[model samples]
Target: MAAYYSQNNPDPSPTSLTFAYPQTMDWNRELLRNEPGMLAEEKLSDVERLKVKIRMFARFIGMKGAETPRWEYERGVEILARRIERRVRLEEETEMRRKVFMGPRAWQA
Candidate 1:
């Protein structure tokens, strides 16, 4: 674990390490791969939230132009959202069919 400073330091360094924004699409893809169960809206919300954090980090590092366009960010999110919606619909349909086929038997222990 890393310890954090309680307050801002009085002295600032002219030479500090900074990193540029890596490809956000790569980040989006990796996030999706890691969280297969995330709902579509949750994924989109997470992406937006992460974008804000990335922007703040860029500013803290004294860098400019780290923000990607809104459309670029939404493109990947929308694609995943569609897939999630389709999956949910399919699951609901499957459950409905199972209930219908099982009828009264489904209620038995």
Candidate 2:
């Protein structure tokens, strides 16, 4: 129709059309790019790692001990002591398992 041509295309000659959103490059490339900053390269020490785990567990359980300590001792000696006890038990269990799996030969060694 004459009205359609006039509204959509003026002059009727062949011309290149431009898209609103061009797809020349990937959008996620910039997002996936990693720039190193102050992040720690090495893993945390055993004490530090255990403390983090214990704190997370306390938060999950909604323990009031995390918010306020019963004792006013500095550096959370009580919490640290509990963490050490748990770690020792885990180590003992691991050693027992290793010994059991290895059988009588382990006892000889």
Candidate 3:
């Protein structure tokens, strides 16, 4: 995995991996084509959460609007933040398990 390190190391932090962000989250792609989930259903869960976040963000940014005054921007922002936190936590847990299962060989692989 030297290639991964070489490319990923340009940025020191884990969040530096822009691969996980939008544009990469292509929902139309078939199930087998995407990265496998950490947990059995994690991939599906993340996709749904991401869709919600994207829609909410669009509304919060006024990219879309509804007639209702009760659904405020701050509320939408909060939902997006919560979804991000959940996704990150699940991803980290998955990474930890992968590292454990592969042990030192994880780096070599």
Candidate 4:
């Protein structure tokens, strides 16, 4: 193991860690925020969070194991539509706030 620490040709200069595709810090931060890595901040157990999430998501798509009826499927679709509408409204509100903060659009109120 003499080669391990024998000055090793100027320490081989720590093979440059590089990304194939370029991405900004904001995009990377956004991605990490949605990732499971954020679970460390949780006061509750991850098990509880995961179980809750599973129940919540299962309620949405009607989980495969849960013998769902036709009406249940229809209702699930309606619920999803409502959720999307709410998300759209929130996003629109954020966009309006950003526009107002930036103060560029003459038409914005």
Candidate 5:
């Protein structure tokens, strides 16, 4: 079977590759408009907003457990919220820095 297959397929080179280009060149504009990290809290979809709320709720419940007090659970949620806000701010700052260093032309094909 090996001998027969090799004899029938003499060429070992790979098939040609095809590249598909976008129909429009408004990708940069689209990217800026749709960037999730840069979006305001109000601009986020209902599901995304709900997910953030659910995360805080879940963290609060986890910290509550069986013997934890209400104040402790509330404090835990507040701490978690602060940490999440800090992370989002940091990401936004990083993205701004990247744009400043790389310039607008960096995203071009």
Candidate 6:
């Protein structure tokens, strides 16, 4: 048992571990500085929210070592936004056609 312990536990003293921590005052100052901006996200429109999400996703993908260029992601987001707009337009047109077919009663319904 002693031989096994000596072989496996040669320097069993607890090692001093150093952790880097930001000064508490600096951390609190930075958090206070950005607090209002964090709250502003709740006021963004649907499209703006989507754009923000896409931008965050692009950043995450870039961090993951993706070879795709930034412009490509931006272009793709623009194309997606245009498609969404077109779809909304078509839906509005369809609703208008239904209203016309259903006569003035459609408005009451």
* Predicted model with the maximum lDDT: 1
Candidate 6 structure quality by residue, lDDT tens digits, 1-109 = 3343343345666233222221132323221223443433223344644554555555554555445456545655665565567779989999998767666787788
Q: lDDT tens string, model 3, 1-109?
A: 4344445467555544445333343434432222544333323346554554566556555675523334334444555565578889989999998667556667787
User: What TM-score goes with each of the models?
Assistant: 0.38, 0.28, 0.31, 0.33, 0.33, 0.33
Residue-level lDDT tens digits of model 5 in 4-54: 334334567522321122124332332113355653432334454444455
Residue-level lDDT tens digits of model 4 in 4-95:
43433356453333222222324232212334543333222445334444554565555675444454355445545655677799899999
Give the Å shift of residue 27 in candidate 4: 33
Candidate 2 CA-lDDT value: 0.48
Query: Which residues of candidate 6, in runs, are more than 4 Å off?
Result: 1-66, 102-109
Per-model root-mean-square deviation over C-alphas? 10.0, 20.0, 17.3, 14.2, 20.1, 16.8
Q: Mark the regions of model 1 whose C-alpha exceeds 4 Å error after superposition.
A: 1-33, 36-56, 98-104
Candidate 1 lDDT tens digits, 1-109: 0112312344454223222223243443533443767555545456665765676568656698866667646755676677778899999999998768556667784
Q: What are the lDDT scores of the predictions, listed in order?
A: 0.57, 0.48, 0.51, 0.46, 0.48, 0.49
Displacement of the residue 90 alpha carbon in candidate 6, Å: 0.3
Question: Which candidate do you rate higher for lDDT, 2 or 6?
Answer: 6
Residue lDDT tens for model 2, 1-109: 3343343555555334322222233312321222354123222334654555565467656787665333324334644565567779989999998767667787799
Please say which candidate is ahead in lDDT: 2 or 5.
5
lDDT of 1 at 27: 45
In candidate 3, stretches whose alpha carbon ends up further than 4 angstroms from where it belongs are 1-71, 102-109
Clashes of 4: 0
